[model samples]
Every structure is written in structure tokens, then in C-alpha cells.
Target: MEQGEFALSDREFNRVKARVYKEAGIALSEAKRTLVVSRLGKLIRTLRLNSFDDYLDHLERQGTPADAQDFINALTTNLTRFWREDHHFTHLETYVGQLMQRRPRGENGRPKLRIWSAGCSTGQEPYTIALHLLAAFPELKRWDFRILATDIDTNVVAKAASGTYPETELSGLSPQQMALFERAGGGQVRIPAAARELIAFKPLNLMNNPWPMRGPFDAVFCRNVAIYFDKPTQGELFARLGALIVPDGFLYIGHSENLGAGGGNFKLVGKTIYQARAQQKARDAA
Candidate 1:
């Protein structure tokens, strides 16, 4: 186990994959061997372990909750940019307009709007949603509106909560958006408190049952997250998501992912967007 070269054998890779799947429900493929090796290499060096095997053993024996958290954080990929898929924002605007029209005003004379950004790595997606909500419906600023941004990785969740980023991270934003939503200084930019206040970032594991929040959200953005899950896992996860959204509520997935043949609870409305069929019917009946 030299500084430059760390060996992760097939046996080690398979073991790690099984552990990841059990803990996080993310199915790592054989192709991810290089990624696993590269990600864990630093942990090995930092612990001064002799090899990947030693690191694994250390994890097994002395692995507290914090150690487990670190392992998952290392293996999970958190690649994202602001408004990564622009079309979703357009659809969100339309959906928000319709929702506001239908939204009940009797709840203390202010309607509630809830959006969930599942697997919100580093917070960009939720922040993007917040900015869009403010831009599309400035009236919402006076109403009760909130976004829940969750990730299994505690590290990313903390970063997301910070609402601060280096200038390089602002590349995905347009000049107008950049001017409107962020305050730039000291070679860095931070989202204004108004936008940051709209989101709550927390750690969540999709595989865990009895989720804490009471949902029926207006929209859910779970993009690029289920790509790592196997088919059965994807089906179950989407079904749960469908349950959490209001009827006619929107579910926005990644450009490359889809709700396959078994997504019976929802109907395709736009590119990579699914509307809950039951929720829509319920809304109509009410």
C-alpha cells in the first residue's frame, strides 16, 4: 500500500459493495472498482493503515456511527450544479402557478407549499428550487413555503445548509440569477438569507422505513439518485416518492433516469416529469 498505489482486490470490492448496498441501498457495479479505490485511498492513508484490508478491518472493529457516516460519504458521489437540468425549472414554474390557484387559503389565510429535493447533494438543487419559487411567485414570499433537502451523506447536508460556495461553483447560474439570488464577496458567493431560509437540509436514507416527515409535497426532485440502485430498489423508491407527493403533484427525475414499466401510480407529464395519478384524481374530486 504505497502512497500512489492502493490495491483493492475483487474480493474486497465485492465486500464493500455489499456493505454499501446494505447500509445505503446503493448498488455499486463492478465498473465502480476504480472509483471505490480512489475514494477510500485517502482514508487509508489518513488512518495510516497498511492496506485497504487493514482499513476495512479498522472500520469493522472500531466503526462507530461517525465512522460509518464517513464511509458512506466517501463512497457516495455528489456531483451537481445549479439548475443542472433547466427544463425542470420551467415545469416547476408552471406547476407552482397551477398549485397556487388551487391552493386552499383557509389555513390561517396563507397557503402552504412544500417541495422536497431528495438526495440533494451539496444543496444546489434545493437552492435552485427556492430561487425559482421566489422568481415565479413573489407572492409566495408572503405565504408559507418551504423546501426539504435531504442526503444520506451528512457532510453534503452540512455544506448544503451553509449556503456558501466558492466563485467557481457559481458557473451554473446565469447573470440575472447570480445578481438576484446571491451576494458575492471575498472571492466567494453566498446565497442570500431569504433564499437560504426557504430550505431545510438533513440526512436521510431512502431505504429506511417510517420516514419522519409528513409529506404530500407539491413537487419532488430526485434526479440522478436512483441510477445507482437496482431495478427493484428503484421501483420501491419511486413508489414511496409517489406516496409522498400530493395527487397531481410533480416528480422530477434525472434526464437519464425514468420510472420504468412499473410506475403505475404516476403519469408522464413532461420530459422526465411524472404526475401522481391518484393525487390528480383526488384533487379533481375535492
Candidate 2:
């Protein structure tokens, strides 16, 4: 057990792959063998395990809940930044403006808006959504608006909940956007309370059935997440998301991802943007 010397046999790799797929719906291909080794090697050594088999045994037989979570955290890839795909937000502005004009106020005499940022890594996407909404629709302060930001990685969820990031991470943001952040000590910037208050960060696994939230959301940003799943899983996930969104509600995905067969309930409206079909609303009402 020298550093970087952990040998992962085919059997061991497949075992890891199967477990990850089963638990998270992430289909790890043969190309991911190197990734698995690199990501888990340190964890295996930290556990004082000499081989992948021993680590797998520990995970299956005697690992604590924390150990299981750490395994998923180690394997989960979270790469995100503010305005990673700028076009989505641009479309969102137009969509929301139209939605506000058409949708009636709630019983409380206030406009209600709910947007879900599924797979919100490190809080950037959700925060970006909040910032954009606040900047474009200043009246949202008087409305009932909330963003539900969820991710499978507890580590990232916790970081996101903190609403803090290195100043360097804000490089892409404009001065107007930068004004929304307060200077956190140690060269970090924290999201202003106005934007932070609009977001609720939680840990969620998309693979889990009967998702805990009752949605019917105005919009859903599940960007870049379904790319990790195989075709069937992707279809099922988008179908479920379709059921949760209101008719005419927007769904923004990653630029690289195509909804494919899963897109039956939505119609393409903009680049990587979709509108949940009005027929869906009729079906739900019926």
C-alpha cells in the first residue's frame, strides 16, 4: 500500500460501478475506471484498507451511515460557477415576466413563485437564479418567492447552505451582480441576505422514489444532472419532473444535454429551455 498504488481489479471496479449506479443512478462506463481509482484511492487508504475489495467489504458489512455518505460524496462530481450557462437565465427573465402578467395572484393576495434548482452544486446555480430574479423583478420582494435547491452530495449542500464562496469565484459576475454579495472575511464573499433568503438548500438523491416535495413548480432547473444517467433513467426522471411542473412552466437543462425521449411532456422554446405542455395542466386538473 504505497500511495497511488491501490490496484482495482475488474471485479472490484464493476462492484463499485454497480453500487454507484444502484444508489445514485449514475452509469459509470469503462472509461470511468481511472476516475473511480483516483477519487476513491485516498478514501480507501484513509480507512487503512489495503485494497478496493477490503474497502468495499467495509462499506457493505460494517460501514456507518457517514461512511456511505462519504463514498457518494467522493464519487460525486460538482463543477459549477455563477452564470455557467448565461442563456438559460436570459430566457428565464422573459418567461417570468410573461408568467407574472398572466398568472393570477394567490389567495393571500400575493404573487407566488417557486423554482427548483435540482442538482444545485455548491449553491451557484440557485444563487444565480435568485440574483437574476431579484435584479429583474424587484417586486419579488413583495411576492411569495422561493427557490428549492437540492443536491445528492451532503458536503456541497452544506457549503451551499453557507452561501459563501471565494472571491475568485465571482469573477464572471458583473459589478451589478457583485453588489449583491457582502464581503466575507478571508477573501470570500457571502450572498446577501436578500438572495440567500430566497433559497432553501437541502440534500436529495434524484434516484429516490416518491420525492418528498410536492412541487407543481413554476420552473425547474435540473441542468446537467441527467447526463450522468443511462437513457431509461433519464426518461423516467424527466417524466417525473414533467408531472411536478405546472403547464407552461419552464425546464432549463444543460447545454450539452438533450431531453431525448424524456422530453415528451415538454416543448422546446429556447436553447436548452423547455415549456411544460399545456396538456399536462389539463391532465393534472382532470
Clashes of each: 3, 0
lDDT for position 22 in model 2: 92
Q: Give the per-residue lDDT of model 1 (tens digit) for 31-104.
A: 88888888888888877887777878888898778878888999999999988889999989988998888778
Q: What TM-score, computed on C-alpha atoms, does each candidate reach?
A: 0.93, 0.96
In candidate 2, position 64 carries an lDDT of 96
Superposed by TM-score, candidate 1 places the C-alpha of residue 73 at a distance from the truth, in angstroms, of: 0.2
lDDT of 2 at 224: 87
For model 1, the stretches where C-alpha displacement exceeds 4 angstroms are 279-286
Q: Scored by CA lDDT, what does every candidate get?
A: 0.87, 0.91
How does model 1 score by TM-score? 0.93
lDDT for model 2, please.
0.91
Question: Following a full C-alpha superposition, what root-mean-square deviation does model 2 have from the true structure?
Answer: 1.6
